[model samples]
Target: MDLSGGTLEIVVSAVVISISVPGNILLIYCTRRCIDEQLRTSFTLIFSLAWTNLIYNLVVNILKIVYASNVELDSAVCKVLMFTAVFTTSLAIWFTLYIALLFCSKLCRVVHPPVEAACKNYQKFHMVLVFTLWVAGVAVCCPVLLYTRRIEKLNTENETYQQFSSLIYTECKTEYRNDLIEILYGKIFLGAINLLPLLIMLLTGFRIVYLLWEHRKATYGGIWIGGDASELEVVRACKIILLLIFVITSFCVSYFSLVYCLKNFKSCYFAPPVLTVLSSGYSSVSPYLLMLINYKVIVRMRCFCCKDEKKLVTVSAIAPVSPYA
Candidate 1:
């Protein structure tokens, strides 16, 4: 039995969506629990990230599965799916950039404590920023809806179709009515979407690592130096920041692989589904990492497992502690 590209895509996309959607929802729930119980608003970017991932999995991957399964769709439906998929993908990229920026700002505070107040005040505007990012996503994807149309062509290459003489195959494709618009949208707009945000994430992630290294070296050269609680807190924060940076780096590398394959080897029969898996690699994986960073999820899981424990012992042993504490 030959496993075709479309079959592989359907299987991979279905698995990815099934896993990522629930993981992102759980991350959101964990983030909310942290906020309500621990009074930590730092979950803002994390929540936004999870939400965007959820949307991408729900919209993009699900549609990919449907398309892979050869479901018939009208031009309108195809346009909507393509536009939504692109919009959510763009939103995910922007949210990652926002997270990198936020972490960078937090590290800046470690260098100059005086900026802490300004950072907190700035964070108060995160909601407005998120809303603006969503608007930008919609604007960028508008062309996809406008230019996309369903096209049908004869499957002349198919040996099975030889007996039938002709078989029609349909696909949703962008129609560039204007050459200038095509060049601008393809070379400039889509180029930025693919490269710019990832570059920002890369630069910020490396800068963060450098700053953390310097801080760690200045505080603890080689051996264990007994430091105050704030110093310890900074170390923990640096570790978490490093973990998230690693996640971002993975996302960049995987997405770059997909883009590179599509651009250079478009004719490869096995590449598309493999690239789709790579494309969703980060979204499916990052939520669990973020949940681990939240700490609340671990505590909640422990509480559920030890529900029969004495209340006094539980309170004394596992009482919620401030992240900085």
Candidate 2:
């Protein structure tokens, strides 16, 4: 059956909320329960990411539902939705990049000694960096508050313009003050904020692969690296980070590509569902991937599945070491 755009949007929003809400909440609970004293920085980043995703799902998707329901909302609500969307998206990207960087630092300390000195104090500044990223996201997204509003139809005789206006009237859309401001904020600034991190993640992923290959080669030789257990944990963490990077990159690339196609080729009627999936797909899926970083969570999940209280107790006493820890 063919669905209208509004019906599809609501359906997509409902699906995203269903997955993202519980997934992010469980991730937050598990991360908090297993926060490592020595690796507080890493735990904090994960916690922030879960919280951001949860907030994004709640604010953006719910508002999207309201909009799709043909309910009239104030311009303030539109502004809030637009602002939250951009702010949360920026925060998620930065948080994921920070986690990847943390893993990269740990791996580099072992695999590449030349960069060890620079990365030594990285953990100490994580809190400062987190604060800065949040503040910067706010500053960068403030323009949304100014430029975004509910689109209303103009008194025009043009059929095409009327059709376009009606299509977007129920949506929160941005109308910048001028061409320059639009180009600057819409194209250049926002593009850099998202694109730069992906570039860094790509470089970090390459470095991680190189380090893993080197470590494996060294192990096959007569060389014995220190702290096999700890190194193994770091290696595991690197693998998770690589996977996380891959997920984020895939979602981002697909989302941007669809956005570009829709902007340039207005007849792309299939964009809505695909765009919705790309937009919220990562938030729904990334938390479960992150749960793999904490072994205690896995063991607890296994115990729960087996319905064995004694196994739970035993798992609790085992003092499982998280890679982040």
Error of 1 at 118 (Å): 5.2
TM-score of decoy 1: 0.81
Off by over 4 Å in 2: 1-4, 112-124, 154-170, 225-227, 264-268, 300-308, 311-324
lDDT (Cα, tens digit) per residue for candidate 1, span 34-94: 5642334457767878888888788777777776555666788778777876777677777
Model 2 C-alpha lDDT per residue in residues 1-325, reported as the tens digit of each score: 1254567777888999999999888888777876665667887898899999999999988887776566778889989988998899888889999888888877876665563345344555788888888889899999989999877745667654333221323256788989999898898899899989988989989989998888887777768454456577778778988988998899988787766545633323444555667878889988887877756655655654577555355533544454334
Worst 10 residues of 2 by lDDT: 161-170
Best by lDDT: 2
lDDT of each: 0.65, 0.76
Residue 152 error, candidate 2, Å: 1.1
Between which residue pairs do clashes occur in model 1? none
